[model samples]
Target chain A: MDFTAILGAWIAVGLTLFILSFLYRDNPLFKIAENLYIGIAIGYIFSITIYNVWIPKIYQPVSNRVFTSLSNWVPWVSKFVTPAGDAGSLTPLFPAIIGISLLTRIFPKISWISRYGFAFIVGYGAGLAIPATVATMFIAQIEGTIQPVFKLASGGAIDLSGPALWTSFSAILLCLGVIVTLFYFFFSLEHGKISKKVTKIGIYFLMVYFGAAFGTTVMGRFALLYGRFFDLYTYRTSGYYHATPILILLVLIFFFVYFGKSRKTSP
Target chain B: MKNGKIAAAVLAAIFFASVSGASAEKKKIEIPPLEGLTARDMPYDMGAAALLEWKIRDCDNQDMTYRIFVSSLAGTGPALRSFTEAGWIKVDEFKGNERLAKDIELPFWAWNASKNIHAVKVSLDNFFGKIQDGSVYYFKVMTLRGKQISESPVVPGAVKGNWFNLSRFNNLFYVILISMAFFWAVTHAKKGNLFIRRITGLDAVEEAIGRATEMGKPVYYLTGRLGMGSMSTIAATFILGEISKRIATYDTQLKVPHTEPVTMTVCQEIVKQAYSEAGRQDAYREDINFYVTDDQFAYTAAVDGMMTREKPAACFYMGYYYAESLLLTEIGSHTGAIQIAGTDAEHQLPFFFITCDYTLIGEELYAAGAYLSKDPVLVGTLRGQDIGKVFAMAVILLGAIGLTLAHVRGWDGLTRVIGNLFNSF
Candidate 1:
């Protein structure tokens, strides 16, 4: 690796160690790394939105159509004139105005103007979401749940083999799970004896689902933790100049000194 | 200029001789016509396409391929036409023995073609000029082997827009039934005739707020990383409005950190209006709702820092969340804060259920607003949703029994019709 790449690896190693120091306690190093993370993320997102969204969608089209059109009388502006396909229309002005109106919330006198933008968003969002939800989530889920239950043999008889019977049992269990889960969340009536029993079974199903999900999530977190530790291990090699071990030593000393003084001063 | 003209004339003569020679070479091999070629309008679609099928039982050559040609001429019956003709367009080409009828997504009730034949859907709108609906279109298939080609007889099919897709009848029925239920419930709710069962999580909101007020620590509320377009965020805002009103009445500090700008803007108005409703507008601070960065982990880190520093007495996590759910809730639990979380994101539920003092699962998150406020409209909507669930359960039960019986009895017709009714087009 080049000198700059090695330096970058060193910095990355130091920062990772600083962040991992939170496992010890919240110290100055952890706070520094946390603030740097937030600051860098804000800068990255702002630049991305400006270049990928605002400049292409708003500034370019408006400047091409409006500014390039003025180049007929002023010749120097012709240098920036775009093709006819892009410069022929002013259709982007309305959304730009609405976008600007959303920023008016900062000004106390005109803050109410932002409501027009929010109202448009909510109204359009609901209009698009309702039919899609019904088609995909509500209707399609019901269709998938109510499946054909039996497998037919080649001669048109019911198959009663072990695998086929297991599939049929699974289908019935799924149907029962769906109905009982729906009962558990039914808000209209109080639960009587039968309803209570059914909902209790539903709660058991929910707990199993939660347990499986928790195991997978914890496994995923461990994999991410392993990735960070492996990086730190690799950086401890001589080519990276022992950046991990040295930085860790310095952090340990700082922690000891910082806590030692505070302990001596306390009652 | 004279020399350039002479070079161009010599090149043209060579190209003409090569074209004639190539045609002669192609005529040396004899390939038979593709048999049983047919074209018909594809069902249950706005008429922009035609489904073409043909038999290919004997070809084993790996290099052989089929080419489809279409024309807008109305009555060009059965005779082979030159593809270089004015209206003909080569729409598609693929290897033989591919694109079987089974590969197509047509419903079983409408399409009963055997799985053995090759099928392709030709979109008429893709031709050079727009092919108008209600006009006749002709299609032909060509089989090619090395330098030789054999053309099938031309077949005609009309294109027309379908008024309705018969496959989505069950969807329409379910929507109409639920809408009528909502209207009926709304009318009855006006007379205070609706009952919503108790949700333990909502009952604890008051106690949590009272604890925060007595301790004189701020109550932190987080609307998760989704925009106003999501139903979960909207429900979260409703619950925020109710919570903020109670906090306003109690004269406790409330801080709402947001990950989406539009949601932050909406929740600002909600909290302001809430405080105004409780006759404590002076107690509401404009900075109660503030924008954090839109980046998920950055927002999580900033909020984690705040939670660690202030150690708020209570934390309310609502709306949709992703991986940051665990990071935020784990810190809240460590701070010894009373945390109540409500979300419809199923994957994130396990984290919240383990960390929070109370958690409202899937639909309960949506119904919490009605349960807390006891508002007629919201309560009516909740009851309507419950009735819709009943409708769904009844269908599931009856459909399961009917499908089982139909399968055991080998009733193919009933199975197809019922299956097609529930299938999405």
Candidate 2:
């Protein structure tokens, strides 16, 4: 392999190992990796948001839309195209002001200015979420819930009831599950014997749902673990030099600890 | 200039000749018409999507691939040529009888009643930028083989940009009805009409802290990686306030490693206020509740390190979480801490349930504070949510019974009518 590719691969393997080292015990290697990742992520976000979001969405559009170049929102492609001269509109300044005010929180004397930004964000977000949540979650869920239990025959008569009996049973069970689950959270009524029975059934659904979710989560976590292990295995199985960084970094960490402890000579 | 124009003409001639194949000079290919061509506005959306559909009549062979073209105005080939220049803007290209993703939003075609077919629908938003809502547009599906092409009859269509989409009216009804229920409950909360069953997960908040005090180690509570504006983080702050007060009374330390500066500031104030209220204001430490980076996984890694090194007696994870939920919870488990977690994030709750001493699933996380303090506003909202649940259960029960009966009785008309009503925009 070429030097750049090999070097990049080695660095990735090193970081992965460092992070995975936490499973053994928390140490300096994991600390360094965690800090590096955080630093890189912070820098990456700042740069990306500046070029991709603020410059295109706010700065360019508002500075003068007539000359605003709205091309290549991604940084990798930087060609520019300006809006037509008739695009002069200052409506974008309102949000720009709110964006700028958020930075004022850094200064204690003028930190109150940040509250305006927060208020705008919270108010606007709450207002937007009302319709969005209503439409996407509430209305959509209800619509999805109301459906035909079985596919009908061409003659429109309940054709072949024997085959479809299980389906009808399952549909009824699903409805019961929904009702009992809803009853599980009801605070108005005390859990008497009947309510307790209903809530118990509801808990069964909740547990089943949680179990399914947990099963999915286990697979997801495994997929991630597999990805990290894949990288370490991919590199080490290839050649001796690829495993050089892994061995050296690990040895160096222990080397410092061993020598430092011996030099202290407290014993 | 003369040479350039000549070269351009030559290029154009070659393009057309190549598109139609060598047979274009002699006998033109007699392309057959497309079957069951139709178009409609995509429902339950923000008027930027239109579903154009057609059957592949000529897909019996491997010679052709289909292409879909769109036009805002019809009978304007010259302008269309200027826009695309090569010909039509090919929105899609598919070989053979490859079917598109099926959409339940569209009504079943009358022609397809006899046979099962791949029902493909395309949304305009995917192909084009926000085209004006309610503006009339045109579509044509073309078939191409060996430079030969067949164009379907142009069909006119428009997406309706609406102030409020009627497709999700049921959801709005639910929201309003639920909100009203909450308002009613809040108004009557003092009257002692609402009866909330005990939540064991919430009750353990005190016990978790007490365990930390006995172990003589710090109690760690990090609201997941979310901004101050998020509802989960806001709720987390509320629960953190209660936890802080309880810990303060015991003179036990509370560590809050916040990701957002603003959230940290709010949390600091909340914890300080809680400590002050508990009459142990002097015991509260400002450094214990400090700012951490906003990078999600990085923050998670930092917390993992803390959990491993410090071995906090109790680790309380509350608020929103993503993949890091597993990392935090796994580390907490290994550290042998009494981990009490609560979150509305359903995906993370399962992991927490399997790992933590006690877990609050979904709405129970939100209800934790109300369950603890019996605050009228919080309790009222919880009660209100229960009423909303009742409405949902009633509707689901009735709908299921009716649909099942109709299916069992073979009443296809009722099925179609009600199904269409529920599914319609």
Backbone Cα, N, C clashes tallied per candidate: 0, 2
> What DockQ class does candidate 2 belong to?
acceptable
Native contact fraction, candidates in order: 0.65, 0.61
lDDT of 2 by residue, B48-91 (tens): 87766666454435666777787764645553444354344557
Candidate 1's TM-score: 0.83
Model 1 pairs whose backbones collide: none
lDDT of 2 by residue, A123-178 (tens): 77567766665555554565676655665667776545776767656766776777
Candidate 1, fnat value? 0.65
**Structure candidate 2, residue pairs in collision:** A139-B171, A187-B195
Task: Give one digit per residue, the lDDT tens place, for model 1 in B238-297.
Answer: 999999999999999999999898899899999999999999999988899998788988
> Model 1, B324: alpha-carbon shift in Å?
1.2
